[model samples]
Each structure stands twice: as structure tokens, then as C-alpha cells.
Target chain A: MIAPLLHVTGLSKRFGGFVALNDVSLQVAPGERLGLIGPNGSGKSTLVNCMSGTLVNDRGRVQFDGRVLDGLPPHRRAYLGLARSFQLPRPFSSLSVRDNMRIPLLYTAAVRAGRQRAENEIRERTEELLRVVGLIDKADARPIDLTQVDMRKLELARAMAADPKLLIADEAMAGLSNAEVDDILGLLMRLNAQGISIILIEHIMKAVMAFSQRLVVLVSGNKIADGAPSEVIRNDHVVRAYLGQ
Target chain B: MTSATAVENPGRKVQAQIGTPMFAALATGVAVLFYVALALIGNEYLYFSGYVVLQFVVMATAWNILGGYCGYVNFGSAAFFAMGAYSTVCIYSIGTEYARSGVGKILGAIPPPVLVPLLIAFAGIIAGLVGLGMGYLTLRLRGVFFSIATLALSVVLQTLVVNWDFVGGSRGAYVIRPNEFPLLPGGFIAYLFVLMLLLVVVALTLARGIERSRLGFGFTAIRDDELAAEAAGVPTLRLKLIATTVSGALMGMAGASFPYYIGYLQPNSAFGLEYAVNAIAMPMVGGTQSWVGPLVGALLLGSFQQWATVTISSVLNLLIVGLVLIFFVIVAPNGIVGLVREWRRKRVLRKAVRP
Candidate 1:
């Protein structure tokens, strides 16, 4: 489909004889908001790990921007404009909010620039990223001082610091009030509108409905459906098994 | 650039650094002179206290590389110190024999005073290589697992040396002090304090650079959450290895100088739990989150233990360390530096409000 931005073919994985993913094939176009939804133990996280190069897939072709990514590490993938936020937000607790964002921004951005960006440039950009995530007021605060929502915002901000073209926000809005969830949903939408492709894996139906332009449903690590959000929700097995319709 | 701007106006912010460069410089100069004056006073009590305090500074600063910034507590630091001390012993003993050999005759032109630097460099290099090797293995494991593996390696190394008679086994080995000639009887107390001073500076520079650099933040990320660090694009494995290796090398340097200070080296002294505990306690009482924490911990707690050991007793020194550590953990978890920082911020805010 219009020369896939991220292409996966024959992706297979196992955890000591128990198959986690089996011959999964998928394609992601550039600047697409793709929602990957599934029930518990559906290997969503594992698939994400494989795609992000945290756990190497046993057999697969993970092609991003015409280059094969088989043995590259997660940081390398991040350097290549692929970033992800953890299901549980992880900010370096020892660093201030600004310093935490500065980590990826300095490393990846400097490398991409092919020369050391001045210290001032790094600081300015880090503050700008923090501002974008609405964490400027708490820039000097430690992660421990942050509420859960702020922690998640920091996580997203850290991912954004890499200036990724593709982002996988894994359960970013989990365990938030409806209003909080909507708040994060708006942030994700704003990021999406800025020409970044976002793959959101979440359980919140309201968010899944609101954010996704295309949806992929997984049941027990197998793709159950892949189509528009409206039509995919109409599938019989998806409704009875996953959608609870 | 923004850090400069941020510093230009602290703006009622608690995390503001007040004249950071000047503050740190004044602190370092004062600390160095304090130890130097104590050494010059030359009371046996001051000398004895001087010795313990200097070593504690080294051990704590060494351990901070891995434990404080990276958040990986290395219970195995004794191994690095032991390696350095034993290397010094081995080199001294072997050099003595060589002093009698055909090679020794040709080398007689080089004064024995120069040998101290030679032996130190050798021991540091050996320890650093060993550290690099140890890091390759232990750095793969994270958190508790990494600590356990390193702790086990420490035991393994101590056992290995205990059985090896070359550097004196469990019975231990003794070395003549540096510049032992009466004409050049080195003021070892002064030397040690100087060494500690320089090391603290080095460690501070390293810690500060890393704290502000990407690696510094990466270390914090790994400490905060390893999974998140990886997701956040930190090369976690590389960062941990670097921290461990640096930690090990510093421990080695400490060990190398130890033999002359104590006049004897034994496996227990070399690989004892006390050394590891002292290392941890120094940073713990200082506030590991910032570079200043370990420096403060090493200076304050380290000196107190030394003075206590001489004025009170050796066993009493351990008690003081234990009490202080417990007090810090239970009360000010952020340690003395954090407390001082809090106090300073409040004071600064009050000054700003004055009409």
C-alpha cells in the first residue's frame, strides 16, 4: 500500500515452546494513526518489543524505510526515528523533568545533526519539548514528585524528544479518569496531526474509537481483523470475543 | 544555553543552583586545606584519623560511579581495592628482588622515590583491566541480579588470592612505606590526604559531567526504570558497563595505595565487607542523586569515622557509621547535601522578598 513505511513479514516468536506470535504480517503507511487492540495475553507487548527491537523476532523481516532491521538494538531503532512509550511510564527518577527529556534529545538529535549541537541548543530544545508536553512548570521536579498523569506525559515527552517519525504509545492512557484519558487522547491527536505516525495499543474503547483511523485487532497473538474502525468493530468474533458487543 | 539562562534567574525555583561554579570551587579548596592542616598538625591522633578519612573518601567516591548515578549497588568494591593493594604488594616484593638482580643494578640510576608512582600506575592499570573484564560479565544482569553476581565475583577473587602465595596468602604480606629512608621519610598522612583530594575532584568532575550529559541522564534512567530507559533510547547496557568499570578502576587505585598506609595487606583487609559498606554509606549519607552528595558523604561521614576510630576505638568507628547511616535513611533520605540545598533555597527566597 503506497510503499509501506514499516513492513513486517512472517514474524514468529516463542517463549519456550509456547508461541507468542506466529507468522504475523503487517504493513504501516507513513503518517498513519494505527490502533492495535487485543485482549489480555494477546502478545501485544511482545509484538511491540519485537518491532521495536527489544526482543529479536526468531523469524521475520522488519523493513523500515527500505532498510531491514533484524539485529539492531532498541536505541538504534530509536535513532532511526522509531520511538515508543512504555505501558508503565518510566522517567529517570534521579533527573529533573527537563534533564530526562534532554537524554534522547541530545543523543539522537546530536547524532542526526552529524556534529555536536551546542549545549545551549540542547537545553533550549529540551525545554521546548517539555513545554509541548505541558511539563515546563515542573521542569525541575523529579519523577517521584510527579502525579501519574504527569509521569505519563513525561514518558510521551521523552519519546517525542527523539523526534520520531513513528511512535508506539503502549497503554499510555491506562488507569486514568475519563477526563484524564481525554486529555491524553488530545495530546496523542495533536502529535498525530504534526505528521508523525502513531500506533496506539490501549484498552480504552473511547480512545481507540477517537484516535484510530485504521485498526488491527489481535486475539491470542493472531490478527483477528484489520480495517476501518467502524467496519472492524462489526466483525462477529471481535464483538463476542473482544469488543463485548 | 538554557541552563545558563535558567541560572541567570532562579525565579523562586527550589532546584536552582546558586553560583554553582563558585560554590563548588570554594567548597573544594576549603576541604583540601582542612585535611592538609590536619595532616601538618601531626598529632598521632590526627595522623590516625587522617588515614581513615582519606581512604573512606576514595572508597565512597569510587563506589558512587556505579551506585549513586547508575543506581547499581556494587557490593564487590572490596575486590577492586584488594586488587590494587595486592598489586602494590606484588610489585614492591618483585621489585625488591629485581633490585638485587642484574636488571636491578642497571635500574639503580632511577631513584626508589619514583617507584611509588610506577607501582601506583601499574596497580591502577591492572585493576582497570580487571574492572573492564568484570563489567563485561556482571553488566548483563540488572538491579539485584547484577549486584549478586558482582558480590559473588568478589568472593571468588578473594578466595583465589587467599590460595595464591605469590602476594602472601591468608597470612598476608607487608610492605615498607613509600620513601622509607630517614632523609625522605614521606609524610604519608599528607600524601594520602592529597590523593583523596585529587580523587574527589576527579570523581566530582566525572559525576558532574555525566549528570549533565546524556550518559548521566541515561544512568539515572536505568536506575529509575531500566525498561523505560531502553524505551527512552538510552543504551542501558553500555552505560552500566561504563559506570561499573569506572567504579572498579577507582577502587583499584584506592587499593594500590592501601598497603603502604596500613604497612600490611591481607585478604580480610583487602576484601572485607567494611570497605563495601563504607563505600555505600558515603554516598548514602551525602545524597546520591547529585554529584555533591558523595563528596559530602565522603568528607563528613568519612572524617567522622576516622576521628572516632582514633579518639574512641576501631569498633566504635563502625558503630558511628552504622548509626549515621540509619539516621540518614530514617530521617533525611536525601542526605546532608539535600538538606543543605533545601536550607539554601529557603534562605535565598527570604532574601529576595526583603523590601
Candidate 2:
């Protein structure tokens, strides 16, 4: 079998006396779409933070693309093609939307390519990403000026600018209209089609079911289910802990 | 292909902008003209006051590197400035000791022209290392906590200086100025002014260069949101350390000539509260967003303080600074550059709507 692109072995995290994630281990195959679902305060964001190097797991190791990622900082993880969007959109408020997009291109993508991208090239790529997210018109607008939906789009687009091998999108579709939900789902689907592995963490079950071939559920910091989405959602523990059926 | 063409068309229309080298050249020309104009005035008092004002320009610009660009407030500007001043004192004291012992004449033999530059370089390195050390210890604490830590750092450094007797400790050390400068047209004061003028040029050029570089973008990103910046692949801690080192080094270079400027270096004067206060106030009053902000702020505020000292009383100088700072904070929080930018933005918007 092919080695997993991302490997987490017996991962654990705690905050003071409270356990946030308890010995959780997971894997994502190359180019796979995995949905991560958890009830509120079930360690979904905490797990993402640990995986992205924003938070250090108390135990276990995270290996990504054949390198151990135990003590690397978030920027180093980003350099190694691991990227995530904050659950709540955290845009660089002072920068114009275009400049915001240009940041990752300047720092991550260009560094990965081992050369400074030409100014014209950076501009072209920024506009292209902005166009993909349907935010070209608001390219020069500050983050404060963007509507909620556009802000979310900007968050995802900024993550995309890193050109990551795996994109863990944390609640990228929250608080959007059905049409807007479909808009983001379509974008994610297009990205997956380009062979970028994605972990879609969302509460929108319908979108998750449609987008994810496999599913992982975290309940009170414990992974109770991980399997095909059709079978995992119907699991007794998942239904009792999360689905409430 | 058509859409690509469309995008390329507008991108190509951007006017050619002035690069850093051109900006540096223009600034150097302007600085020379200012120096010549001051010399033509033929007033030694102007050079003396001008030196103080230019010193503020350097300090304000240095403070803005960490405080304004990176959003890390440094309340210990005086500590770094004093470090530079005291480094010179230590060297002078050691040279006097060496001269008395008849061990070597190398330190005493170095002329002022060569000696001042050497002292400036030495002070910059020493203060930069301290800044790095301080940043490593304190940069993890963000917001007001980081600022308070810097204030504490100032007090600790001042205590160390007060107790170190080799450089005269609490009493102070006397640095007798030579009657004349070797190559310079003016006296020692004039020589000091010219050195400060060159330092201003270097500081401004360096600040402007950083503002336009990729590093500048990273700094602004960290300033805006450090976590987000890190996630965007910026090494936030590394960048902050760089800012601290550069800022501290520049402030140190500004203070290296202080002993010569005053001819008497006292702990109270070297670690004065005025240095810290003026460093912060000048940037805030001028606008902290760009290099121009600190330069303008320093010149305006420094000149006013000089004028007030001469025309009015020196005691009221701090009071005037305090009042002006309060007025700007209330009326124009972004400072003069920000105000100008806001005005110009409104003008452009009006024109666009009219057409």
C-alpha cells in the first residue's frame, strides 16, 4: 500500500487538567477528501491547531510528507505544504485583499519554488486566486470592508495561496446561505479535483456527506468513528454522541 | 487567453516607481543642501540645537521599526541610547588608564575623525546584542505586557550603570572636547552635527528600504495579526528579533556621540526619561505608518522643543511635548502622514465620483 501522506500516531493534548484530545490517531491517503466532524468543544479546532503546528500535542508524533513534525513552528509546517484556515476567519485586517493573497505567495509558494517570484507573477497569481473565490472586484478592499461571505472566501483563498499539499479547512462554510454554501463546496471540490488532499471540517452534514468519501468523528475529544461516511454516520456511538438520534 | 490579456493590460499600466537607490540619492542630496544652508547661517547655536533635533530623528525612526511597523512598543529607548553613550565612556576611561600605564598609545592616538566612527560602530554592535538578548527574553509577552517589560529593562540597565564605578558610576565622567575638528570646517559641535546628519541619512534610508522590501510586508503582517502571519509562512519571532536588533542598533549609533556633544556624561542625563518619551512621542505625533512619519514628527517636535527652550523656559519643554502629543492622539491618532493620506484619498474619491 502507498504510505499515507499525513500520519498521526497516538496523538494527545491537554489544557491544564482537562484533556482536549486523547490518544487520537488518524491518516489521510494521497488526494483523499476526509470530513472531520465534532460537536462544539469536541477538540476539532484543537486537533487542527496541533496538526498545523499552532499548538503542540502533549504526546505522539505528526509525520507529514515523510518528515517528522514534532517541534516545528506553524510557518515551518506551512513551508512543508501543511496549511489550515482558522475556524473563524482571521484576515490581515490592515492589508488590501490582493496584498493578503500575495503574502503566502511571497513567503510560502515562492520559497518552495526556491526563487523570488517576479512582481508581475505574484500579481497575476494573486488576481487568479481572488478570481477563483469571486473576490476580484473587492481586490483592493480591506478585510473590514468585506462582507461575511467574502471574508470567509478570503480566508480559504489565503490558505490556498500557500499551495499546500493538504488543506485542512476549519469551518470554512459556517454561517453561509445555502447558495453560498454550494459556492464554497464547489470551490473545495474543484481544488480536490486538482489532486490536493483536503480535510473539510464543518457542521453542515449535507455538504460534508456530499464532499467526503471518508469521515472522522470526534466526540468529547475522543475519536469514536472513522470509516466510509455512509457507514460511520450510522454508527451507534457517533449517533449517540453527536447525531443525537 | 483573453482574460489573461485583460489582466496583463491593467498590470502593465502601473507607472514606473522610484526605487530605493534613487530615493537614497535624492535624500543624500537634500541632506547636503540642509547642512550647507545651516552652515551658511553661521550660528554655532543652530548647529548645537540642530544636533539634538537630528538625534531625535534617528531615535524616532529606530523606535518606529519595532513599535510602529511590528506593533511592539519599546518603552526602553533610553536604555539603548544610554548603552551607546556609556560604551563611549568605557572606551575613553580605558584609554586614559592605558595612557597613564604607558602600555599602549593606540586608543589615545586615534583622532576624533576616526575615533567617533569607531565608537559609533562599537556601540551599535553592543546595543544590538542586548536588543537580541532582550527580545529573546521578552518578545513572547505581547501587548502591554511586552511594553511594561521594556520599561523594567530600562530601570535594570540604569541600576547597572549607576553601580559601575569604572565609568564614574553615579557621579559622571568628563569627556573633554578638542578645541578644533581636524578636517571639518566648523568646530567640534559642527563636526558632531555633520555626523548626526549622516546618521539620519543612514537611518532614514534603512527604514525606507525595509518598508518596501518583502521583510517589510512580513513585518506588517506580524503587526496586523501575528498568528495569521505565521500561518501565512512568516517567521514572526525571527522578524520581531530582527526589528529589535535593528531598532536598538540605530538608537545606539545615535547616542554614541552624546559624550562628545555634552562633554560630561552623567547617569541621570544618559538614561534620561526624555529620550524614551521623545522617541515614542515623535513617531506617534508624526505618524508611525511610514519612514516619513518619524522624520517629520521628530523635526517638528524637536524644533519646537528647541525653540521653546530658547524663547521660553526649558522646564516647559516636556509639558509642551505632552500637550502636543495629547492633542495629536485625540485629533489625529494616525499622525500627520496619516492625515495627509486620508485627505488625498478623499480627493481621489471625489474626483472619481465626479467623472
Candidate 3:
């Protein structure tokens, strides 16, 4: 019942008259872990993009930490402690692993927080982020040299570099092994425990169920359910429209 | 395996690979030889041809900024170059007239030698500004559409220049007689070889700097995939504009020296498809993966073009470029130098593995 750290009211986005997200609304409390589940093409990414300021919504507003995020660009949003890890890990392939970690902190976190971390400080922080993602071994390696799991880890680590209050992880666990899913799930939980809110968008139900404190489902751009993970998973409409399928 | 491990830095390695002591000596030797030839020959034809090739190298290396590293194919390179060339001419033209009036003696007292870098800087800035404008207009389009839009912009700019008589549109404007410096390839050609040399250094340095920086990482990612880059906090539109603008400006600076070098400024020649082709070719021939490829491609192909035109003709130069381009695409899509380096690396790996 406490005030939500993030609030979305009457959110709507349309692509050339095709509604990608229609009247979608959800909220998350500070440091709460949330899972956003949906069928294929069910506005998950559109919603993420809208909130992250990658795309501007036509109607409604997203309020993060009490600031209206209607016109802010993604970097500015990141400066306000918003971060996102892509579905397909998109690290800077040409740069070394350490430099990839250096970007967000150098460009956003250090600048915004007015915490003038020195070169060695940034380097140490980059090393720490890489270590958390189990990628310290490939610290000097290029993204092109990384395997799929490593790329995903780099992507998550990159988002984490922003020192964000909320991390929108879109399909972070997709196309991973069973063990890899658990590994990512554990990371997300650890991140949540560190007072970082997460909106996990994934197809893997087990990881979602295991990680999410609150669950939300989207069916054809509409928010169908937003409540306790157990209650939302057992909802009849969700099963009929999404889960059973 | 150490060398087999993919290089964390892309363009730097290309530069490092080419920056060997022997290669640098050879390149430096060739450049000195060309300058010597131009200085001693005093032949108008040879100097003019040398000037043309030098200009082409400048343009090609400049164009590589966007087309090669950022993966945005800019066909409207001439717009900025022509703008650049014209700006310098206008500024020089105005300065000479101002010098003639009551202000002449007072201005003459100042160190006139400062004009060279001033003009070069002004030319680069003007072109960069033009590039900024064009980037804003055409950066939204990608692939062939982007190329076409930029080309169309060049055409529009060409027409605009053709109408503006102050910039010496179709009639061609001539600046006051330049100082008769004895630096081989008299007048503008000498100035241009020096300009070309400076540009090569600038392009190489800028390319290497960006390729190793955070901006460079963001750029390659955007080139790889836009949506994915955006999701990862790489600002796409802003980066593309900066790339295209800087790319445009460098070409513009290259263009800025053209009026003095050619001694005649015309819209058609300044804003031609030849510039477009040369720009695209340099990066491709050089191996767009690294900045060195463009310089290497420029030196090799540029020297070959110079030799061909002298031994054969200008048409033959085009034929060589066309053939070489086709050959590179088929035999080695990464370009000649890249292919050679790859071959050498594989050979080394194989040799080391022998038990």
C-alpha cells in the first residue's frame, strides 16, 4: 500500500495506427522485483521503450521517482537512474570488455551523481561489474569474442553500470540454458536485494515465478493482470489468454 | 593464439599493423619523392595531376569517417567540400579587397603568414557547419535511401552555388594572384599536397582516437544494430549526426583548398559524382575495419592512379579503380591489406603449431 516508486498511468503507444500498447498501466514499489509476462508481439518491448524514453508514447505518462518521463531521452532517463538491458545482447563489439563497462559510468552515472570518480576508480568499478557478471576473465576481450551467455552477461553488466534505481531487463533470460536461466535469475534477485527495482520481461515462466515479487501480464497490448506472482499465474483469464497457450 | 585472439581494438590494430618502422619509412619516402617531383618538374600538367590525386586522397579519407566506421554511406560528400572550397575563396576574396581599401596598409603590418592555418581552419569549420545542416536533413534515412538523399542534397547545393555569383557560380570566380612559393607544384598544388598530407594525418589521428574511445564503441554498436544499441544506452541519432557532420566537415576542409589549387572554381567539378565514388572507394580499398586501411588504400590506389594517368590516361585510372574494387569484393571483401594481414597471421599460427 506504500507509494509506488514507479507509476504508469493510461500509457498508450501506437505504431502507424496499429496499437502496440493500449491503455497499459502498472506500478512497482521501490526495490521491488516485478515480472512482465506477455505472449509474442504483446507490447512488452513497446512498453519498455516508452518508459525508457527510447520511444515516446502518444498518451498517458510514466512517472519514475516522482518525475514525469514524457519527453526525456534514454540517456537523460538513465541519468535519472533508469536502465535497460536489450533482449539480444548488444555490447560494443569493437571495444574491450572493460571499456564497454566504462561507458555508462563515465557518460551517465559519474556525471549525474556528481561523483567525480577518477580513472582508476572507474576502472575498478568496471572490473567489479565484470566480476559480478562472471566475466572478469574476458575483461580485456572484445564483445565479438564473447559467447552468447557472456554477451548477455555483458549486456546486464552494462545496464548495471548506470547505478540505476530501476532496471528494465527485456528478455534477459531468453535463449539461455536451464542453468544459465537460474544464474541470471539469481543475479536479478541479488540486484533487487541491493535496492534496485527490476522489471523482468521473459518467456521463461519458472525464472519469472522464482524472481518476481509482483507479476503483470499483457495480452494483445492490454494489461490483463498485476498482482501477487502466485495469484496472477493462477488467474483464469491469464491462463486462457496467455499461459495455457 | 595470442595474435589469433581477436583484437579488442579494431582500427588501432589496422594502424599499428601499418605503422611498422619500415612501412612508415617507405610511405614517408614516397611522399617526399612526390613533393620533390612536383617541386623540381615545374611542369604544369604533372603538378595539376598530382594536385588532383592528392585532393582525392583527402576526400576519400575524410568520407571514411561516416561511411567506414559509422556505417553510414554518404554520397553527398561534395556538398560540404564545395562549401568549404567556396568559403575559403570568399574569405580570401573579401580579405584581398579589404586589404586594397583604406584597411590595406594596417592589415599588411600584421603577420600575414598566419593566414594559412586560419584559412584551413575556416574552411574546415564552414564545411563542418554545412555537414551539420546536411546531417540534420539526411541522417534519418539509412542504407541506399540515405545515400540517395545525400546525393540529391549535393545536386541541390550544386544548383544553389551555380546561381550565387559571389561564390563564382557557373562563370567561375578567381581570387587575387597567390604568393609564388617555390614549394614544388607551384601555387595551389603545392599548398594542396601539404594540405593533403595534413589531412591524412588528421583523418588517421581522429579515426584512431574515436575508434579507441567510448564514442567509437557506441558508434560500432549502432552500426551493428540500432535498436539494440539504443537499449544499451547508446544514443543513436546524436551519434550519427556527429559522425556525419565531422565527416562532412573534413571533406569540406579538403574542398576548401580546391579553388586555390585548381585556380578555377566551378560547381560541376566541385560537386561531382567522382568525389562520391572516391570517398566510398578509399574506405573499401583501405579496409573500413580500421583507419589505416583508408590511408593504405589511398596511398596504394592513389599512387597507382597517378601512375596510370601518367603512363596511360585518366580513363585508365577509373578502370583500375573499378577493377580493383571488383577484385577486392571477390577475392577479399575486407580489402587488399586486410587480406594480406589475415594471410600472414594464419601462416604464423600454422607455423607455430607445427610439432
Best by lDDT: 2
The per-prediction CA RMSD against the true structure, in angstroms, equals 3.8, 3.5, 5.1
TM-score list, all predictions: 0.89, 0.96, 0.85
lDDT value, residue A125 of candidate 3: 89
lDDT measured at residue A59 in model 3 versus the true structure, 0 to 100: 99
Question: Chain A of candidate 3: what's the TM-score?
Answer: 0.97
What DockQ score does model 2 reach against the true complex? Answer: 0.55
TM-score of chain A of each: 0.96, 0.98, 0.97
**Candidate 1 lDDT tens digits, A123-200:** 788788888888899988889999999999999998888888899999999999998898889898999889999999
Task: For residues B44-154, write the lDDT of model 2, one tens digit per residue.
Answer: 899899999999999999999999999999999999999999999998887787775553367887887789989999999999999999999999999999999999999
Please list the residue runs of candidate 3 whose C-alpha ends up more than 4 Å from where it truly belongs after superposition.
A96-99, A112-123, A138-147, A243-245, B1-49, B91-117, B175-179, B182-192, B344-355
Tens digit per residue, CA lDDT, model 3, B118-198: 667888887787777777888778789988998888888888889987777798787543656554346544665666666
Clashing pairs in 2: none
Clashing pairs in 3: B39-B184, B84-B256, B85-B256, B286-B293
Off by over 4 Å in 2: A243-245, B1-16, B100-104
lDDT tens digits by residue: candidate 1, B1-355: 4466343333122444444464457657876777657646655456555566666777787788788777888888888889988888887766666777875554444554556556666777888888788889877777799889988989999999999887899999888765334331236545654565665565565566566555666777788878777766778888877887777777787777778777888899889778878888888999877777887788798777666665889777767788889999999988888899789978988999994
Which residue segments of model 1 deviate by more than 4 Å?
A: A243-245, B1-32, B39-45, B100-110, B178-189, B343-355
